[model samples]
Target: MESYTGKSIFQKVAVGRIFYYEKNENIVKRNRIEETEGEIKRFEAAKLVALGQLDRIYQKALKEVGEDNAAVFEVHKMMMEDEDYLESIHSMVREQKVNAEYAVAMTGDNFAKMFSQMDDEYMKARAADVKDISERLVSVLLGNGTDMGALKEPVILVADDLAPSETVQLDKSKILAFVTRYGSSNSHTAILARTMNIPAVIGVDISKEWNGKMAAVDGYTGTVYIEPDFDCMERMKNRIAEDEKKRQLMQELKGKETVTKAGRKIHLYANIGNVADTVSALQNDAEGIGLFRSEFLYLEAKDFPSEEEQFQAYKTVAESMGGKKVIIRTLDIGADKQVDYFNLDKEDNPAMGYRAIRICLSQPEIFRTQLRAILRASSFGNISIMFPMIISVKEVREAKRILEEVKEELKEKEVPYQDVETGIMIETPAAVFESGELAKEVDFFSIGTNDLTQYTLAIDRQNPKLDHIYDPHHPAVLKAIKMVVDNAHEHGAWVGICGELGADLTLTKTFVEMGLDELSVSPSFVLPVRNEICNL
Candidate 1:
């Protein structure tokens, strides 16, 4: 028996035969071409083919992983159509007088290197994306179709790495789990695995010699056992049964109040990125919609989302909730979430730079448009508006002033709308310190622990090198959250945590003791958290 350890993406157990996946290599050789125009035509034709393939993958991913995760393919399609990328490939093919595959391979390497050298970890990950698209183009040019072939039986897939395009194309039903030699928690493959609810382990040294061998994957411990002994197999079987029992128990928790043993009730809400996610929220029995990320509308758009488009999205989510409170954070763009149409200037430090409420406040017209849309949709169901990255009471006042202006405009236009409860995200130390004054200006406070931790610790959460020290559970962060909750309550403003830490069951008791009014997490976590709170 051989055992290996790695990082886990999801917690589950599986026993299956190992399937070593080896992708067909697209080795390009440079050859002098007589007709540069012909090579350019060939490159364009391959681009079209690659784009078509990306569309099909995007549709498949959309159905399997929902819109937000599916957007990765859409980004790939956009990258394929990027004018600069296309220009580089075309110029190289024409000037270098090389085969289309060669030009594409060279251009891909150059572009990918640029992205890899970027300071932002999110941008750095794009290196893999460029390579994925480049490889696809090269394969298409060589008349080599990119397919993983069929699996006759389910198995634990082991690969060196998986590109997002490749991950989405795999047959989900046949994949018991993923055991990759190389991948990060932030990799799109990891994201897709979580979305598909497949257990995955990365950074393991896997061997093709183990192919077709019996294996047990303990995703909870990030352990892989090959040719496992009888004892190990028995333990794995028991663990799998326990996991199944826990899932069934979670389903029985639906419609149960998230209250502690002492009778303290916590409003368990779900954080969602779009209207489509409301289905998951309801299926998981979320009492309300908290942290409705409104920026996806802008991020997914070709240009600025018009008022009507924004209105329809918000309205759909609000109506879908069927009067459950939906708190929409308005246009938290910039800082990792970039839109080409916004034309935001390059920044040395984007995370703390012109982002979220700063962008909305600086560009009040854009803020006003979103406000109008939210107000227009407020009448559809229970809806509220929250401004993000606010650090001062003055910013909150300015935002509310604009909100009033938008309300007046609607009244003048004789448009029907409803008043929305206003709130601000407590994400920075400045906001925590000023929570008393800021809370007085808003109806509630949603603690965005992700940024609060980042700002309080003065650490870049996106930097993997700092991952060891980037503790969201740091004492300062906890104190900051407690302070915000206390200050908000003193000002008669309810407080809720809408960050990843909110879903940390270990802290559920602490949060309840802190007198938090609510905890909003991903839909999948709603029940587990409710169960914890109920037991507490």
Candidate 2:
């Protein structure tokens, strides 16, 4: 047996046969069509057929993954129906006198490559959208649609990587696990694997020699054993059983309140980047959404997201929480997370540079649009607005002034929106020192330990060489947390911690004693954190 390791999207175990997913290698590049009219007709006909297939996929996705996720297929349909997109294809067919399949392939490659070349991560992802539609059109033109069929049997799907469209077309029932050679933990495949509760490991470049081999996939350890011996198989089976037992026990904690040994109740919440994550958040019985990273909206869009678009997404997530407190953090851009469209100048020191609330305050119109959306979404359920990377009273006041402007705009339009509370992230050392005064200005205080630790320790968490010095549990870090907790309570504000530190089991007791009212963590950690709280 040969064992390989990578990174797991979620922790699960699966023993299955390795099935290499093959891509279509044969595609006609160019074919002369004497009848120009016939070629254009063929392109139009192929589009209609693609739409029919997309409609079925959309319906299935809606029923299987929910509306927000199902919108992937809907997006493909819109792209196919777009006048500019169709014009490009039509021009290729008419001017170049090429066949419909060739025109589609060429156009798709051009557009996809264009998006792929962009600096923004989300815009670069749109390359997948172009390829998805183009592939469907070309397949229709060629009279062959491989994406239409189901898998013959269950297997651990092996691929170099998976596109968003390819990932969605998969049959979850037959997918035992997903093994990829290239993909980040935040890739579409990784997110889908977590949402569907499937085992997945990425960045492992497995050779074809392992195909058809019986494998034991361990997501926790990121190990894949190919053609394992009887002894190895037995050990893996036992490990799987043990993990399954632990999972079953964790399931029992769902919907139960997190109470400490002294009967102190604490709210346990989930942190999410997008709306689709609401499923996993709720499944783990999160009391609410503690940190909604709203930058995803701007990141995913081709340009700055419109107010209505932001409003719909926020409203959907809020409704999904079903009146549970949903704290949406405003755009936390800059530092490692940069937006190309924002045209931010290159910075020598980005971590403490212009970011988050600084960007919003500098650009009032941009900030106003987001505030309007959040206010509009407030009507659906319990929603609160949070500002990150905050350090001063002046910045907080200016931000609130623009928020008030948006509220007035909504009122003039007679929009139905609930009165939403506002808060600031206690991340900077400046904020921590002035926590008492800062707490008095906001409805609540959320200690963002991720940045707070980085800024306080003067260590770039991203720098691997500084791993030894950058301590999350440093004495200074603990002292800052205690100070923030004490100040928040003293000034009539609740305190919560929404960072990697919140999920640390060792710190749960310390936080409880320090008077933290809430702990926000990832979905899978919700139960473990709650269970730790109960034990304490």
Candidate 3:
């Protein structure tokens, strides 16, 4: 028996035989081509084929993982049509008189290197994307298929790493879990695994020799046991049964009120990134959407999304909730969620630098565009707007002033819009102190514990070295949350927590004791949280 440990992506236990995934290795050799134009033509044809493949995969992923996750394929499709990428391939083929495959390979390597060198972690992850697309194009040009082939039975899939395209294309039902030798929690593959609710562990030292052997994956502990002994297998079986029982119990709690034994109800809402995620939210019986990350529309787009585009997305999610409250957070871009079109200057400490509400206030035009969209969408269903990273009362007033101006514009134009409820995210320590005055300006306050903890601890949450001390459960952070809740209540403004800590079951009781009105988390967590609240 052999056991290895790595980082867990999802907390679930699985017992299965090991099925080592073998990715098709495309080896492109530089070949002198007499006709450069013909090579370019060939590349263009292969590009079309790749685009078609991506479209199919995108649609499939849309059904499987929802829009935000599926949007990676759309990005891949966009990459296929990127002017610079095409030109690079064409220029290489024409100037160097190389084969299409060689030109594509070289262009991919160069572009990937450029992205990999970027300071932004999000952009750096694009390196894998470039490589994935390049390999796809090369495979198409080579007259080969890039399918992972069907599996006869479910097995624990072990691989070096998986590209987003490859991961989505696999037969998901046949995959009991994923054990990768190399992957990051931020990688698209890891994100997909989480969305699919699959048990996964990354950065494991896996061996191909374990293929076809009985194995158990302890996702909670990030341990993989290959050909485990009887005692280990028995323990794994018991754990799996317990996990299954808990899932069944959670399912039974669906449609039940998230009320404590003493009859105090907590509105258990789901947080979503895009419209399609509303399906998961409703499926999990979320009372409402507490945090609709509106910035994803801008992040996913190549340029600033038009007001109409934003309206349609917001409208869809609002209508889908069927009058359930959808608190859409206004564009919280900058810092970690950087967009190229924003043209933000590089900052030494982006977390504390210009971001979120600061960007919205600095560029009111952008803020107005989003507010107009949200107001327009408000007429369709229950929709509330929230500004993120607010620290002062003045900023809240300025934001509300702009909202009123947009409302008047809509009134003048006789465009239909409802009076939307307004709120702000309590993320900074300053917000905690100013919560009394700030609460007077808004209908609600949603404690963004993720940022609050980061700021309170003065720890860079993104820095792996600080992981040891990046405690969201810190007493100071909890006190800040409590302060915000008390201040908001004093002004008759309800408060909720809509951060990673909200999903922490250990703190669920603590939050209830703090008199939190709501707890918003990912769709997968809604039922479990409700169960916890109900039992409380």
Model 3, runs deviating above 4 Å: 7-9, 17-24, 27-175, 178-196, 206-214, 229-231
For residues 444-481, write the lDDT of model 3, one tens digit per residue: 99999888988999987755456668788889999999
Backbone collisions counted per model: 1, 0, 0
Give model 2 RMSD, 1 decimal.
Answer: 10.1
For model 2, state the Cα shift of residue 312 in Å: 1.7
Evaluate residue 503 in candidate 3 and report its C-alpha lDDT on the 0 to 100 scale.
87
Q: TM-score of predicted model 3?
A: 0.76
Ranking the candidates on TM-score from highest down gives: 3, 1, 2
**Candidate 1 lDDT, 187-234, residue by residue in tens:** 556756764567899889999898899999999999999999999999
Instruction: Give the per-residue lDDT of model 2 (tens digit) for 335-368.
Output: 7665556878656577878889998888878988
Better-scoring candidate (TM-score), 1 or 3: 3
Q: How big is the positional error of residue 463 in model 2, measured in Å on the Cα after superposition?
A: 4.9
The lDDT ranking, best first, is 3, 1, 2
Clashes of 3: 0
Candidates 2 and 3, the one with greater lDDT: 3
Name the weakest run of 10 consecutive residues (lDDT summed) in model 2.
Answer: 142-151
Give all TM-scores, in the order shown: 0.75, 0.72, 0.76
